[model samples]
Each structure stands twice: as C-alpha cells, then as structure tokens.
Target: MKTEDEWQHCLTPEQYDILRKKGTEAPFTGKLLHNKEKGKYICAACGMELFSSEAKFDSGTGWPSFFDANKENIATKRDLNHGMIRTEVLCKHCSSHLGHVFEDGPNPTGLRYCINSASLDFRK
Candidate 1:
C-alpha cells in the first residue's frame, strides 16, 4: 500500500483521483477508450499487469472495456456507493481502484471490466 504522500507524488491529480480516491472519469474522454493497439493494460500506480489486449473489446461504454482480465492480478469487493450495488475492481498488489466489473458483457467470461484509462498504462 502506498502512503498518501507517495501516491500524491507518483500520480497526477487525475490518476490519483481515479486510482487512489476512487473517482471516475467522464465517459468517452478516456485516452484508451478507443485504443486498438495490441498490448497490456497495466496499473498506472504499480505497473501490475491487469488486462491483456486480447481480452479487450469495444463495449461502447466509453471506457476501456475488457471482457476478461488477468484474474489473479485483480481483487473485487462489494461496493454500495451512489445508492447502487456494484462489484468494485482493484489492483491486487496495490489495492488501487481500477473500476467496476459487471455481468453485462460479451462471450467467454461474460464480464465487463469497465476501467478508467487514467488508472492504466498501456504498453504496446
């Protein structure tokens, strides 16, 4: 876990907000929202491998959507924020917020990992 100071120093305000403070960026504004490259999406905070390019798909949700993730690199918990119940996905190593996973998704895993681009670093 990173101290508040460490997080502040390493992350930009936007990155810290989404990754540490659990905030969401506006839809359709994410850098990786339309990314079609072949690479891995890694945690911006800790460089942990989270999702593979092969698992990515255009869900049209304006976020970087993936049907599946590197399951072992992620951890989830029940979140009851905004008067709604959702499963919050976080980086397993750093516990930084990535986004939420939902059941409404494509084939294979049938899960949608709607992640914030600010929370990720794409390597192609």
Candidate 2:
C-alpha cells in the first residue's frame, strides 16, 4: 500500500483530489466523457482494470458512464454526503475513489458506473 505522501507524489493534483480525497471533477469537462475507442479503463492510482469500452455509453451526465465493470477490481460503499445517499465506487486493489454508480442506465445491466476520468487511465 502506498502512503498518503507517496500517492500525492505520484498523482497530479486533480487526480489525487478525485482518487484519494473523493472529489468530483466538473461535469462535461472530463477528458474521457466523449471517448469512443475500444480499450480498457484502469484505475489511475493502482492500474487495476475497472471498465471496458464495450460497456461505455453516453449517459449525458457529463461523466464517463459504463453499463458494466470489471467487478473483481472494484468495490462500493454507501455515501451519505451532502444530504444525498449514493453508492461510491472504489478501486479494490488500492481503495482509491473512482466515482459513483446509479441504477438509471441502459438495458442488460441497468447500472451506470458514473466514473471520474481523472481517476482512470485508458489503454487500448
């Protein structure tokens, strides 16, 4: 496991904020929001595969949305911050905050893993 200082050293300010501090990036401003390539989305902090392009879709929520995820690489927790209850997604390998998941999504899984682009790194 990486120490807080080490993690801060390794990640950029935005990445550290979103992944380690559970901060959300601005809507419609994520770099991966419009990505439509075939690849894997891995955790920025730990490099664990999180989502695939096949499960990605435009949810129009301004974040990168996925119908499915590499379940083995993720974990969820109940978030009650800001007077709202939500499920918070994390990278299982490192426990880094990825984003949140919602029930409102397309068919098949009906789950939208609304993730932060700063919390991820793409690979083809």
Model 2 pairs whose backbones collide = none
lDDT of 2 at 4: 97
Lowest lDDT sum, 10 consecutive residues, model 1, at 31-40
Residue 112's lDDT in candidate 2:
96
Give the alpha carbon lDDT tens digit for every residue of 1-124 in model 1.
7798999999999999999999999999999988888999999999999999999999988899999999999999999999999999999999999999999999988899999999999999
TM-scores for every candidate against the unseen true structure: 0.98, 0.99
Name the best candidate (by TM-score).
2
Worst 10 residues of 2 by lDDT: 41-50
Compared with the true structure, what per-residue lDDT tens digits does model 2 show for residues 2-40?
999999999999999999999999999999999999999
Off by over 4 Å in 1: none
Error of 2 at 50 (Å): 0.5
